[model samples]
Target: MEQWKDKVVVVTGGSAGFGKAIVDAFAAAGATVVSISRSPDEHGGNGERGNVFSVQADVTDDESVAAAVSQIIQQHERIDVWINNVGQSIRVAFEAATMEQYRQLMEINFYTAVRCSLAVLPHLEKSSGSIVQIGTLAARTGWKNIAPYVTSKHALSGFAHQLRIESPDNVHSLFVCPGPIRRDDAATRYKAQSNGLGDAASTPGAGVKISGLDPEWLARRIVTSIEKRQPELVVPAKARLLFSILQLSPRLGDWLLRKFAS
Candidate 1:
């Protein structure tokens, strides 16, 4: 908490989901939080700490994103940490989905992070701050349905790695990969987007055999990781074994998945 007392943190898509959880966590930790979302009205009131501010911006628009950064810098004078947490996911078979649909989802899930991160990077560099890129297990593992989301995350994972490799010692880019985040409507969140995938479409990660993580718990871990300057955070720690296996050999990874499924 003390670590963030004097810092200025900016979170994109902080109106809901993991983004909102992260905003609350940082505010509780005493950091001045700026939450930028499309519908800032829906973002509601500030946090209990009275340190949260909301900004409405279309993250995919270069000018909108730049203006939001300008506004934050003008008001706060500096940015100590910038978090790119805005993302959307959909469930559709690769064949059933169109290139246009894929592009649209990419705009929300991938390019939003790219734009927000690039816009705030100079200020973060000035403050020797950190950049947090929220990702999902989809970034590492290829699951049935949701090729667009999976491909976007894979790009994000690569981007985060490049950022970390290129960032100065004092600046850090943290990539977080977690399983399904528990949501109130988790059971049917993807009903309309399912494209006839049935029960699988109604579940997170297309009913991947994994537990949905509590968003609040994951947010807390993210806050601590920022303070520790951790490069990558994989929740349920044991999940890393699977990611490790996937990387070592695709054949072995498929065998393990098949074994686990059986």
Candidate 2:
């Protein structure tokens, strides 16, 4: 905890959900956390000028992201951590998904991270900081009826890997691959988008048999991983079996993916 005291941490899409949990966790660690949100006033901050500050920025737009990064640099001087946590998910079969949907998902889940990472890379280089990509188990493997999401996250996972390969030794990249996070709207958020794909298609994780992860606990684990400079982390740990099988035998991996479906 003392290790993070006063360090500048920036997280995108931190107004709510698991990203908000991350903001709270970093603040608890005594880091000066700047949470960038598309709408910062909505359930963002308490108006207390504490260790956490919320800034309004649309990460999808390069100019908006650039402006937000500049403002943070002017105010904080240096950024010790840049977390590309903005992500979106949807339910649609690859055959039914539109090019527009693919573009939108790619913009939100992939390019947002790329823009934010590029915006802060120089400052991070100066501070010898870390880049954290909040991804999911789907980033490692595929799930049904969410091909665009899986595709976008796969791109994000690759970008994180390339960052590790190219970044200097002082700069670290942490790619987090967690299981489905429990949310109140999990049952219905994508029901309308099911497109005759059935309830399993609408369900989070594409009805994968894995239990939902607690967001707060996941956030704490992420902070700890950042501290350890762990390159790639998969929650529930057991899920690593799928990635291993996929590498060793694609046939067995496909069978396991089908077997894991609820």
Candidate 3:
């Protein structure tokens, strides 16, 4: 945290949820946090600690993303860390999800990260900065519902891996994979509406009581990982083992997934 003092940090989709937590955490740690979101914060872009600067940008649009990055650079002159945290999801059966929905999910979840990463690459290269990509557990396995969301995350995971491989030694790319996260009120409402189709269309894991990690805790861990420059951080620790088991024993993995879905 001490290392982040005066650092310029940009977080996309930082107005709420994990993005908001990350923005607040970094701001509290003395970094200049710039939050890029379409909606403006109620506090007029200033965070609780008065270190967050809000910028309105549609990450899905290339020109908008480019302009946002340019504004950040023009103001801060350098970017120390860029967190690509914009994502969205809808719960529905794979067959029920339309191709249009899949494309929309990809644009919001995958393309935003791609556009932002490319937009900031030059500045990051100059600063030897870090790009932190927020991923989901769905990326590691095939889930019952939310196929489009899972597919988009899988694509993001692949992109991040390749980017890390080709990126300069000085520039670091890290991905954070977490399971079902505790949602905020707005997110809960959105999920409810998305699941309103019928009982048959209910979200997978609807009644399951799976404990979720706190956004603040996850944010702190992410900040610490960024400070340490770790390549990847998977929440709950057991997810890594599950990922391995899924790779090595497909039948067992399928059984486990079925149990989870049940």
Compose the digit string of candidate 1's lDDT tens values, residues 45-70.
Answer: 33223798888788989999999999
Candidate number achieving the greatest TM-score relative to the actual structure:
2
Off by over 4 Å in 2: 43-49
**C-alpha local distance difference test of each model:** 0.85, 0.88, 0.82
Candidate 3 regions off by >4 Å?
Answer: 41-49, 190-209
Decreasing lDDT order of the candidates? 2, 1, 3
* Model 3: per-residue Cα lDDT over 101-130, one tens digit each: 899999988999999999898889999999
The ten-residue window of minimal lDDT in model 3 covers 200-209
TM-score of decoy 2: 0.96
- Taking all chains together, each candidate's TM-score versus the true structure is 0.94, 0.96, 0.91
Candidate 2 per-residue lDDT, tens place, 178-213, comes to 998988898888888886987788777889988889
Q: Of models 1 and 3, which has the larger lDDT?
A: 1
